[model samples]
Target: MGKAQKNKTVGRAEMSGVERLGLRVSAMINSPRAQDRCAALIHRMEADQDADWEEVMSRIAETDGVSMVFQDDGGVLLEWEAPTDEDRVLELGEVEALEVEEAPF
Candidate 1:
């Protein structure tokens, strides 16, 4: 078969874990409130010495109005959704959308 025909013969496949995570982050950035929440969470994570990047990502997903997928050190995937919180809404600073990086190592 020709290269084009060979490619067409392959079936569609599911997105990889990294792609799913990228989509989640993209959704958050597109929403002003969610973007702010994520940025604040990044700051919080940076401030904590013992925090794992993936775990911090999960917590960001948990804060009041966000959703995300995080891959832990064990190579397992975890999903989180924001919980309802009545505390003051966190203000988001100017957010520059990130260029999609290569998949998780």
Candidate 2:
């Protein structure tokens, strides 16, 4: 049988407005499939203090594997599929060291 997939959600309850926006923007910028226009918009957002936040959010909503829902409190809820055990990378550096006894000379 196939395993059930888990989803993760981030929102106003967990972070401030600026933090949430930063997370969303970072996700969009890191997406490999992001379009040139989106890149331009992101650059503009960085350069312009008065950039249109709604436009940035609308673009975020269009990202693959991501969804944004507007809340009644004027906040957004971001949801995406959580990584599974198969998605996790094993790091050799994180392995515990083995203790060895010194050989008699």
Candidate 3:
């Protein structure tokens, strides 16, 4: 992946006992939910004063398929398996938007 961007550190030891060594995670992060989740991670790093970094890694490691990529410039990149059937339903063969109700002031 472009020499891993030169300064990125592949998270090999982010989780001691977690086996995410060679998991193949998609480099694409174009999905809305995926992007939102990554943004939340960044926001957490910025706003959560008492955030547990390792705990966060561990929680992610606990997921079925996951990986971590840390950039040299304090940027955190997450790699996770696409949503499971139980986690999300993607076959939108037929979908209809519901009307929203306005709130009373």
Clashes per candidate, residues 3 or more apart or on different chains = 0, 0, 0
Q: Deviation in angstroms for 53 in model 1?
A: 7.2
Q: In candidate 2, what are the lDDT values of residues 42-103, reduced to their tens digit?
A: 33334323444665576777878766666665555555665467766667764445456799
lDDT of 3: 0.48
**Per-residue lDDT for 7-104 in model 3, tens only?**
37564436432222112122234557775564222222343223354554556668666666776765457765656567774454423453567999
Return the TM-score for candidate 1, rounded to 2 decimals: 0.26
Native-referenced Cα lDDT, model 1: 0.46
Could you tell me which residue pairs clash in candidate 3?
none
Top model by lDDT, which number?
2
Error of 1 at 89 (Å): 28
Which candidate, 1 or 3, has the higher TM-score? 3
lDDT of 1 by residue, 1-105 (tens): 898888877866786554555455455455667544443111222323343445545655565644443335322222334434644454444223435579898
lDDT of 2: 0.55
